[model samples]
Target: MAQWYQTWNKPLKNILWWLVIIGMVVSLPLAYTRHQTETSANQVEFVFDYRDLLDISDIQTNPRTFVAEQLKNMKAAGISSMAVYESTLAELKESRRIEVYNSRDAAALTQTLGDPNENFTYVLFADSATQQKLEPLIQKTFADLKVGTKPWSFKNRNGLIIQMSMDDASIKGMDPDPMTLQMLKDQGFQIVVRLSNRRPFVTNEMDRLLKQLHDIGVKRIIVDGNEVPGYTEENTEINLNKMADLLNKNGIGLAAIELLKEPQKGFSTLSKQTNYNVVRLHSFTEKDGEKLTEPLKKSELQDRIQGVADRLVLAVKDRNIRMVFLNARPVKSLDKGKLVDPLAAYYESLQGKDGAIPRIQEVGFKLGPAEPFDVKTTGWQKIARIFILLGGVSLIVLMVSFFVPEATLLLFVLGILGLAALHTLSANLYAQGLALSTAISAPSIAIMLAIRSVRSGAAAKWKSGLAYALWTLIKTSAISLIGVVYEVALLNHVTYLLVLQQFRGVGVLHLLPIAIAGVYLLFFSENNTYRDKIANIRSILSSFISVLWIVVAGVALAAVYYYLSRTGNEGQASTLEKLFRSFLENTLGVRPRTKEFLFAHPLFLLGAYLSVRYRHAVYLIFIGVIGQLSIVDTFAHLHTPLHISLIRISYGLVFGALIGLVLIAAWEIIIRSWKRWVPQLSK
Candidate 1:
């Protein structure tokens, strides 16, 4: 049975390779379709927070005039939209649309003492238009909560008295201020409604509100709280589907905020229900705004502005963001003895030669209403994905077979069974698992193949070795990109593109390939037999510990810990590193990753060259694995456009090769110097 299994294993492995190649060929069209989808949305919107602007205006002596002037400034500064939130009494007061008073203040205005027994909330409109626009909305809002209201007069301005404490009445939620929306529209700026789930989900009321917004030319909305509009935890009837239906009826899509602490509840379901009419938005927080406008030197302020512009440009050009939300606050500048706002700096960042607007336009996006990607599916996509799955599983089995050759047939069978079980559990989990498996396997196999080729040939002279090393680098990167194609094919859904779903197992992708390559180098390289490698491993395992080994182990552990720390988005970079990144972004429209271009790719190229002659230099293949894995990892960021990742990888390879050539020349010089001088010194 054992001999028969061995006889079949070799042929089975060959079949697996064929299946992987066929899968890749089948996956190419799917990847191209995804590329088409990514290019569908080309317009970007810049929206300023209306509430933040209102807060800034409150500190001015002429608040109303200040707001009007700033709105004009905002429009001139390329801010095309204003994000208006649901109204509260406090917000209305801040906007100068109305005034709120408790019983005591109302009595004082009338020159009478407070009526303690009849404590009530009072509101006075700024004008007849305000009164006409807001009175019924306020009345209906409070009446729904069973709060009583009656007509009141204060110095001939029409007002209402509510039978509730001032504190209780102030917190009631109402529809977004109609006056603000109309004002924004009249100013030639689009309106982006901000919705919240603070009120009860009433279908009739929501329908009316959406109709009103549609009339005002509102194109999209963003949820302001932890849940999407109409989501209710305790009410099964009030769900995202109902909200999606209303949005669809009104022709308003959703704006999904980027990098929230926790994803908005029911957002994913709502996105799907709306047929993925969702655009990604990146927000400049009030805190970030304050930091940008801090008292700093002219050069420092310029650097900060450039950094912000680069970030915004990348967000739109590379990460599929269609909306940029800017927030602002008044900063207390003790040096100037006044409160300062970031409006001027914000404007500068958006409207100059080096501003975000020009930078964005240079990259093929126009300043207009942000729109969702036009994602379409073809009938052949599902069939192509099946081949991709087959290829991914075969590649994984082949990687395992390297260590367990006799069990190649069994591994392939088990891979099929495991894929079925995983798919039964969750289709998403199955796809992510296979993607991660193929990602690891492709790089490991590529590096091992290079190793085998190196071992099969005699060492070459430096002149020919240079060309050989470059060829090896190209070949290895091509193999790794096959995994990238499979991954993109497997996860070619709008959810992944929108980041509603993420590729899992990033840390494993970063770590496992290097580890597998290291193990292969130690046990299988140089045509070593399995018995010889097993004995070598046992001898090392049984040997007594040495202090040098312990020290080396400690250093390796620390190195690994640091490497893992830098693997994810949460890694902290130093100030100098940030400056360098900014410089790179300015010089190169799309910055290749630092590790790939500067560290991994360069070292990998050098390793490929050195491994030709020095037996000990084979260890560099472990480092080379990093470049291979990184190539595939770049595509794992599904939010990044396929073309952008390709450009970045291409830049990494070119730059890495150039730097590798320099290293090769420097090493050659050092070696010749040593050969010429060391012998004379010994004599």
Candidate 2:
């Protein structure tokens, strides 16, 4: 026992023993917990759509200049107690506030002899009385005084609001100075001309005003200050319907109409009555400016934005409206002459269902905290523990294989199978959406076992296999580590796109480590001249047979498989079995139809090719039994007849023969070169 331990122990350098033991011990808890968590992990996905409800598509018109000029006209009216405030560039930059210049600044600046130092326009806010006062001033300065006001106040001031109504005589007597009006008009000024006097077109007054407005070529009008008479709750519907029909028939495609009271009570009724497609209107107004126009706090803004978004969604869903036309007071109002705007919030909230709105979907389970001890209710720990335990057992078996040199062949077979089995398990776990912890750990036992066995045996014969396994383990570990790190940190939508890019990079680099290991193994081993000659001869003959008969058989079987897979044949499974059995019988001389003569003939290169033929026979049989089906084909695109033919012919004939040639050349060189470094191990 001591001697076996000594032999095995010496090969695994002291540093490696400590590393293996410590690394495994530390990884146990993490691996166990990771697997448990992975099993419980679930992804929640939701999809929302609000295209028909919030008809952003309908509002696509050029309103930029119109809004700017309207704000300008409001300022020019000299509406007392109304002020025009300028938003600084810095403020605009910080808040994305769209600043509109008032006509007062436009008129004053134009009349100045030189350009003013300031380069800003004003936003105006006033009560109804003040607005009416400003209307005459605008009429005096501008050719068209299109004055408008709601029955209720819609400005950011904290005082009593009084509304004044003038008689026809007073309106007729108010003559605007032509030159002043022209100057005001040149400075982008206009009138907020009111149409109704506390009621809609009574006593032929509406017809007369409409005629005057048409004669003057007035394009925009604000039909405000109209209060519909006597709402008997029961007949309100009839009256509202009458109003909508009348407005629609009149061809009034103006910007706004101030509705004095709630035309309809229910959300559905409001949606149906409000003709957003025709014009926007403000129904409710503030009597106390301080109460209505107050700036929202940060929290208030967030809540209001969310509430508005929710209401908008509900309105769209219930009303069957294509677009929404909001009252302009939200943006028009000001506090202490300063406009309190929530432009960012408003814009962000308006994003339709698919754009930014959260979708409602099913969520199965709540996620628990991810900690070593506190990992709540994920299956990662159980599964990870199993893999870690398997790895530990594999390691112990690997150590045993080191001393039991005769068991080396069995260990090698197990190692190869283990690698394949673990990788397949990893892929399955990944497909199931299990977290990284559920994946079987890549076995380093392969390298450890190979090092222990080869360090004590005839090195030349099996050292290549050991080197191959060693490099594969290292490559896989590096790849997995990098992939895990990337997944952990990736979150944003932009970075998610890079996932495919990273995979491409990894795939391109995959072959390099194997080539490097092959080179290292070739150079590091002691070489025998006689063995090199024999091995080379064997390699050449094997390559020829592999390229010819073996390749032909592979191509034929592959063609059958491809056809069967595409046709979705039920008989293909049994046919595959027969084909594989036949192939095995032909290559290994194992079935009733075996050719004894071929196995016995000395000229047939029996001893040199027997192992290759036997192994390939088994491999071919296995391939046939586990024939690639259409479902599998869809994923890997592996059943292409052309690709299969090319792989067999090119890899088997050209590359295989070339590989044999390279091995021969390398063996000969190694025989000469390695003699100086290492003595050949003798059985």
Candidate 3:
């Protein structure tokens, strides 16, 4: 009976094992194909809406025509910097700067002759904020100019090449009264007081400005939006209501509230009591000014504009408002001679549908197509995948269960030891699973060889050979199980979060299941009793120490990476440190406030202590998992919302109770099985 069993079991088991091996080989390529198919890109379509077009007739008129013409010549010359001399003929003869233009002739003849000097600056007839937005662009374009100072900062656009300022002679209405001049100055009109007309509460200068604005092609504007600079009558309720109704009646589309700067003074009756929904306006300043004539330059602008456009379009699509106002530096000529179609231009800039700008534009706008929605893996698909992977692993395990069961037990233990070691070395739990798989494959073959050796009586130490083979299997299983547990818990949390938050980090937890399966193998190695294995605690300690050394090596490597990144390496040391710090802070709830020294922190000591202590490993694992699981509250670069110490205490208590319950249940099962078997054996 023994002979027949041995002879048939050996060949039959080998054949069954080969079938499982074939299945695994088939799975790899198929799995790769499935993964690729799932992640492949495909075309999708969606509608998009663009923002309102700019109104620029004021910059295109007679005196202002020179500003537009100079800008046009500058664009044509590709020389943004220019110098304006007193005489046009003198400037044209010896000067290379863009020739100055007189206030009238429709052509407003300004032509660039040659290269302008680095210090050459443009004359802007606009306010300080409008001038501020030109520095970055000017500096980059005429890079040699080092035109880094904003227009508003300098006494004049250093050379007054292309000027944008109100014509000085246009200020005519003055009663010549000291009190009135003082009152205008006190009312905050050093440059020009654009006031409300025919109103009991305010002056009439704004009505005159609006008339001038209309003459210069400003068909629609809201004078009420312009906040009077120095009108600090404590109760502005009546003023705001009258202003709002006046604006609504006048059909003004834009308003500029000036110097109501204190946002936290709390909403006054102007905002609270009125129906005029004030959309906060933001626009380009001298500090933010950069041209976008190039393709990539425009792409950047498109992205930013489209992002805000998409948000607002979605938000305000149902409203009757046809145009929204933004403060922007005036645009005269977009490209040398090409006229940008205002209606078509704004629509194309929306970055929607076929009109979307190409991805290469380099502009401030940071817009792009919305990311593809990720489909949640259904339960059946997940179950199928999990079963297939586990089945392949279990087949190998089953083979070990047949012969040299004790060796299988040892291998399982060793595999777990290797897994924990690998995890410490590489924070990835899935890498530990792969390492366990590779480590166990060799042991499986070795056990088979050892069994053959014992069967043929080539070596007399059959019991010892069986013990070694079983030991190998047990170590492998332990590693596999530990890895599995790590994987399951992590993946469960991660997948749940992905479902909840729809973030990419959700897939990060998927690695945990692989680690758990690897760990499970460690716990259930074939035919080895816990009593027999407990005697090898010294060996377990040695393995633990060995893994600890590898962890130390990893720490040394991380330290070296940190040091080189900071000191001499031409790399982003600060960025790398921030990334590492972010990961650690999330995992340990031990965020170092400053980026001064990461490796030398007390947390490193804690990690070292946990590495050396087995009990601490359990605590660190739970703390690490929960710490990673906790929501991060980030304000700028600061991350909050994790309390590592609390997490450790809570997880330790909960997991300890769980482990105790499992042990008790396991003990009870063992006793029941023993009672049933022992009585039968005695009978």
Write model 1 residue lDDT over 74-135, tens digit each, in one string.
89989999999999988999999889999988998889888679889999999998999999
Candidate 3 Cα deviation (angstroms), residue 472: 34
lDDT for model 2 comes to 0.31
Q: What is candidate 3's TM-score against the reference?
A: 0.24
Best by TM-score: 1
lDDT of 1: 0.87
Q: Provide C-alpha RMSD values for all models, in order.
A: 1.8, 27.8, 24.3
Per TM-score, what order, best first? Answer: 1, 3, 2
Better of 1 and 2 by TM-score: 1
lDDT of 2 at 205: 33
Q: What is candidate 2's TM-score against the reference?
A: 0.24
For residues 1-683, write the lDDT of model 3, one tens digit per residue. Answer: 66665565445445545544444443444333322322321211121110011123223435334434433432232221111111211211121222222233212223334333222323332344323432232333233222232322233433233221113211212211122223223422221112322223442433443344333322223232234321245645555555444443443322222223333221233333333232222222222222322233656756544544433332122111122222223444545454322322233433444222222122111222112212223344434333334434444455455434434434444544654465568544543344234233323333233223323333343344324323432332233233222222223221111121112222223233223322323333223566655555446567755687999879967954653454311436455554564454434434432221221112212222222222232222222221121111010001101122224323433333344334435655897999999999998
Candidate 1 minimal-lDDT segment of 10 residues: 454-463
